[model samples]
Target: MKKRFVSMLCIIAFLFVSICGRIAYIVFSNDFTVSESYNSYVLNLETLYPVIYYYNLEKLTDNRDKYAAVLRPNERTLTDLHNLFPSSQINEITNELKAGYPLVKYVDESKIGNEKYIKTFRMSDYECVQSQLISKASSGLLSYVEPCGKREMRFHIDALGRMLRGDEGEEFEESLSNIKGIRLTLDKKVEEIAYSALSDMQNGCVVIMDVKTSSILTCISKPDKSYLNKAFSQYNVGSVFKIIVAACALENDIEFYYNCSGKTTVGDTEFSCQKNHNHGFENLSDALSNSCNCYFVNLAQKLGSKKLLATADKLGFNDDIKLYDEWSFKTANLPNKEELSSKGELSLFGFGQGKLTVSPLQMCYSLCTIGNMGVKNQVRLVYSSLDENANEDIVKYKASTRVLSEETSKELLNMLRNVVENGTGKSAEDSYHKSSGKTATAQTGRYILGTEILNTWFAGVYPSENPEYAIVVMKENGKSGNEDCAPIYREIVEKLNYL
Candidate 1:
């Protein structure tokens, strides 16, 4: 009997310990309960969009200054930034959230009675904005917070008691380039600006047109001091001038198979490759691809300055081509007869490193000329005249004139295409699109007494079988054209691929 009693006592002890452990668990679980409450509040907060529901204490019907906080609105404004929301007025938007306001049918606020406030919202505009934001956010293009130069197009206003437009007065003034219809309003927001010709660059513009129909696509420039259509005013063409050297060589009957012994001594001066290492023996195609100064200088000695100057002038280097707006670009200080007589300087001109100055737009024109198989077009920045009705009237059908033999143009193009595929410009390969181009690293700034820094470049045309577009990219003080400019060109081409 005593043994049976002891066994029962042991069972009773186990039961007591289990109950105490259950109590301890309940006591330690305060964090879990608080977390659940916080998550539930967050879920409720996300549903508010077009309409914000908050406190409305007026309906308490109690004879007290503050009637016990019972008549609270379901929502309140989270931020006072009116520049982020362009569509809503504070009072009108939040009115439905007031106590005793009629609830919309699409949204369910039935959980809270008429006396209590429940936030709910639905709007087509809000849906559209949300969809666009979500789509762009995943692509790493949109940000929840504004980055520098990227301002929110919408906002919320607290001081005005309504949603107000963000003040864009300073930006509109500063952003004024070759842009049209940009006017500052009394309210400080930009009233309107034609989007076609707007440019962020300090001075930049583009004039694109369809040749057959003479349909103008875009004419844009900014900083009103400059015009889009003129090519007489000088800008650094940088290494883009290499296209001229390539043309001069072929025009002078330089064979693509001819070889350069890498280094050539002219008088007492020695001109060598940027690598300083010898290319040993390379053909004309490789010389052009590798941008060999010795090979081009040797060839330029044969072509002489007269032929090179004539070729550049014929290709529209000397003349000013006007784009839309008042902008103009022109070639700078061409080598004279005396300078061209020196073998070293003449060779430098062939490689586009010394004394040969042109504009970025001009270089683009030369590339287009080559792509058009020696037909140089009268470069048009604006293809039509804008009427009073804002309709574009066709004014010009710029036809291309023969600049070089078609065979010569094709030969040079094949050599450039091969460069992109196998030589110095191999990095410029567009996996998303097929392109043909060449890289150039022209010395622009003096690094030491004799040596100079390079301005890298990559110029090309796309869809090689039947070309449609040509582009040039230049990076100042870059180490190599293949390294710096080619990647930028690749990105620009990829962006243009879908368009």
Candidate 2:
């Protein structure tokens, strides 16, 4: 009987220890009990997209990979997460949140829940913002997304949809999860200007970047009716591609003069200029400024496909630029080098015709390299991101590489400057900011009811004397670059001067 009693005592002891240990784990182990109590907004500077995903952490492993996938830890620290969500005044947006959007507060309790401010919320409340994040976390499709620009901004949301935070540290009040996200490098002034230009258009995209920092200043694609914003869309490059041809020629030392009688025959295929009028004798610089197609056709044949591909590669053509570790850009597609053996094919490739398709961002970055004295700075959208932990992070981008020699880039810039000052891009010249850019009209064999459509482009760098920004303005089914795009470029410069 004593032995049985001892065995019962042992069993009770084991039960007590197991219960205590489990309780201890629940109380002390950080992983067992979720430590993260909050989340902030996330944004992309390069793509102009906002990431508004909020996940319920059921242990870190369950949602970490998925959370990190959308809201990348670009360059933010959890400690400063409060900055991502400021204490701003309660406005119409706050009213909507009170009526039902997820309302979250990061500041001291004293700073929130006052009149004209958002009501404080619980992270676990289903009717609160936390619940919305949980719902989205389980959802296969990201549903909480919103545009940060060109909309009526509620607090941090932007001028009701047509603006964003202008100066940092502007005193605003908000007690909600929606009012949080990183400020993109996009200058509201620039974006407003570009948007104003394309406001009436059905399809077009404009991009302007700081040459030195490679930070996007303005990125707007018109008629943003679809989630597929056309700013990231691809197009046939057209003649503005002559810049690449010219650069390749300069790189390969295949310089020569050509006399254009409006057109040239390549294996029985006639390549004609837009004017179709003889340009007489022309030097390389003059040909580029005049946008003489006959010159580029001959130049491409002389340089051959090999040299053209090399220069295009150096300029990041047919490649993807990984942006802030959030997402990679789509590749700028090009045709196979060997396929250009035909003189007719090489002639088309010479002036950016044929199968050369690229995105506005890629073209902008390539021009940025030329303006940056031939060095290519890694293109980025956001300076940093606020991770789930609220940590602020700045990406450590790769070192700049020399794509064009200093001399070659200088000559190219000079030619481009002359283009604005005297060539087809003369209309883009501005009194506030002298600009030099190239204009091209890319033809899409796709005709609309018998009328052929073209992609009009004006790509150039600003303050010809001191390069600061590289801009590309493109319009689909538009006229030549000078007619449809140059005027818009001038307007962008005028706005930049005011900003």
lDDT of each: 0.50, 0.67
Every candidate's CA RMSD: 22.8, 15.2
lDDT string for model 1 (141-209, tens) is: 122212112111122222222222221111111121121111100110110111221323233333222
Choose the strongest candidate by TM-score.
2
Q: For model 2, how does the per-residue alpha-carbon lDDT over 1-499 read when each residue is reduced to its tens digit? A: 9999999999999999999998776445433322222222322211112332222112211222111101111122222333333435323323433332222333343433332222232112112122211123422112333322321112222212211222111122223233224334556556567778777667788888999877777666665543344555789888789998999888877768999999899888898998696888998899999999999999998899999998999988866776534356664887786778777888899998887788888889888988988998887655554443546555577888888998888898999998988889988989854888899889988998899999999999887756888999989999889988988888888777765
Q: Model 1 Cα displacement at 302 (Å)?
A: 1.4
Clash number for every model? 36, 31
Q: What TM-score fits each model?
A: 0.54, 0.66
Global lDDT for candidate 2?
A: 0.67
Those runs of model 1 whose alpha carbons end farther than 4 Å from true positions after fitting are: 1-240, 256-261, 324-327, 397-399, 447-452
